[model samples]
Structures are given as C-alpha cells and as structure tokens.
Target: MEYIVEKIGMSRTITVPSQAVTLLRVLDAKVCEVNEGIAIVSYNSGKKMNKTIEGQQKKYSLSSEFNRFVTLEVANTEAGDLDLTPLADAEVLKTTFTTKGRGFAGVMKRWNFGGGPASHGHRMGRRTGSIGNAEWPGRVMKGKKMPGHYGNIKNSVKNEIVSFDAENNIIAVSGSVSGANGSLGRVKVAK
Candidate 1:
C-alpha cells in the first residue's frame, strides 16, 4: 500500500547506542474512486484552491479541507477512508522524495572536484581546469563532471520500519530519508 506522508525530520531511538531514524507523518486521505489497485485519493494541503479543485470536491463530495487530489495504490476496496492496516504489518517501506536543491553549483561543490592549489599565482583555483584536448577532441565531452544544476532530483530509498504510531499516524524508519523537513513524499510498503 501507498500513502502520502510528510517528513518529520530525523531522530534517534532511546536505547543503548541509539539508532538514527527518520520520522514520517502520514496525511489523512480519503479514497474517492478505485480502479483496480490504483485509486484517486484526496487529502488536505495548503489553502490554495482553484475552480478545478472545487469541481473535484463536488464530484467526490469532499470538504474544503481536502483540496488536493492524487492517484495512489491503496488497500481500500471501495471509496472511503484510507486504510492504515497495511502499514501496521509492513516491515519495510520504499520512500520516494526529492532531494534538497543546491542550485547553480560549482565543480568543487557539485562533483567533489579537488580544486587547483591555493597559491598566489594559481588562476585556476575553483574553475574547471583544461576541459578539452589539444585539437584531438577540441570540444568539451558530454557527461563531463563540470558544474551545473545539483540536487532537487527524485530519490528513492528502502528503509526498515522501526515503529508505527497508528493514532498519530507517525512512522519511524531506520536511516535517513531525502527531502527537507515537512516536505511531502510517498511511502510504499516494500515488504
């Protein structure tokens, strides 16, 4: 089963040699329609809404709080509240989230390039040093380790479930998860 969740940041368990865990809060969602294993689910997000969302609310007979809609693989057989039973029995989860964006980065920060010597006469301190061959392949090659955009890309990680608080809809999983705190992501039961 899949659920939309928000990253609650990372914390450590209260035991001997505490293990690091990433906490995720499952958002309250209602299944609107089901087709095979995928269903259109509605959940509350920000207050921003448009006519299209209003029409969806009318069609699904949902309240104004449930302004956002997404299609997900759910355990519900029919349209209703999202089932949380699957998560209780799940031993692992595959989390998919976007990494933090570090826009317009340099080669040193982006590709971990060792810059030129920090001497007084060196002009290639942080620049890409000699990116071409002498008349052999005069142009810079494609997929070179030069600087450009970095991060803000989709990343997936499989984590073992540490604990699940059903009443609060919070899940603690082993290790770290991508994205900043409070960022939204999807978690699918892997095991």
Candidate 2:
C-alpha cells in the first residue's frame, strides 16, 4: 500500500548527536477504489480547489489541495489487516518530501562540486570547469554536471522510525524529510 503525505515542518532534535528532525503530514488514507491490480487510495481534502483539481478529485476522491497522489500496484492479495487509519489523521505519512522549489544553483551547493581554490588567484574558482574538449568533441557531452535546479525533486528516504501520539494522533518520524513547511508531499512506501 502507498500513502500521500505532506511536508509539514522540521522537528526539533530530542536525543543525542543533534540531527535535524523532518516532519511529515500523513492524512487519513482510505481505499477509494480497487481495480485490476491497483488500489486507488484517497487522501481527501476539505478545502475548495480549482476546476481541474476538483475534477480529478471527483473522478478519484483524492484528498489534498494539490495534485499529489501515489499509485500502488498490488503484487498479491492476502488475508491481512492494512492499517489505513494513519491516512485519516493519526499517522504522519513518511516519504522524502521534496521542496516546492529551489532555483538554479551552482555545482558547489548543488552537487557539492568543491569550488576551486579560494586564494590561489584562480578566476575559475566556483565555476564548472572544462565542460568539453577543444575541437575534437565540438559540443558539451550529455549528462555533464553543471549549475541547475537544486531541490524540488521527489527523493525516497527509507526506514524512518515513527512515533505516534495517541491523544493528539500526530505521528512523528525521525530525521529531516525535506521541502518548506506546509508544502504538499507525495508519500509512498520506500523501496
């Protein structure tokens, strides 16, 4: 099964080592419709959305303001209890919550491309050097690392142990997730 989650905010570190805490918002997930080998889980929203979004929601009963939905293909159907109450309001869906955006960034920050010497009088410092050869190649090769969009990509982080509050029904996952606070995150099982 898959879940649709949200990037709520970063949590404060409670234990040792001092690592940043990542927070996720897991709505109540419900089995809307199951057909073929796919389970269409609805994460439903109470807010009003645009016509296009409303149409999609009506067609699928998807929960959430944004078009953030995950499809899970069933490998086999066995007699089991799939606890989906977490999708309702208890369990914080765990997934690598990508950011809404990070604009163009240099290789140094993006790919950790160690910038050139800072005090060697080298002007090429911090710049992606030698994109291609002189005349033999004639053009920049494919898959060349360069400055570009930094974040906003869905990255699945695995095995985030979660702690839930029985009273409040707020699920807390350890470590940093991603994205700015209150951004829509598509949560799914980590493979």
lDDT score at residue 4, model 2, on the 0-100 scale: 54
Per-residue accuracy of model 2 over 126-188 as CA lDDT, tens digit each: 898778888877888898899998777777665354565544434467676666776655554
TM-score of every model versus the real structure: 0.97, 0.63
Residue 98, model 1, lDDT: 94
The model with the greatest lDDT is 1
How much is 44 displaced in model 2, in angstroms? 4.6
Give Cα distance to truth, residue 4, candidate 1, Å: 0.2
Q: What's the lDDT for candidate 1?
A: 0.95
Scored against the true structure, residue 183 in model 2 reaches a CA lDDT of 66
Clashing pairs in 2: 22-175, 26-93, 27-87, 28-87, 28-88, 29-87, 43-63, 44-63, 45-63
How much RMSD separates candidate 1 from the native structure? 1.0
| Residue-by-residue lDDT tens digits, candidate 1, 54-160 | 99999989989999999999999999999999999999999999999999999999999999999989888998887887887788888889889999999999999
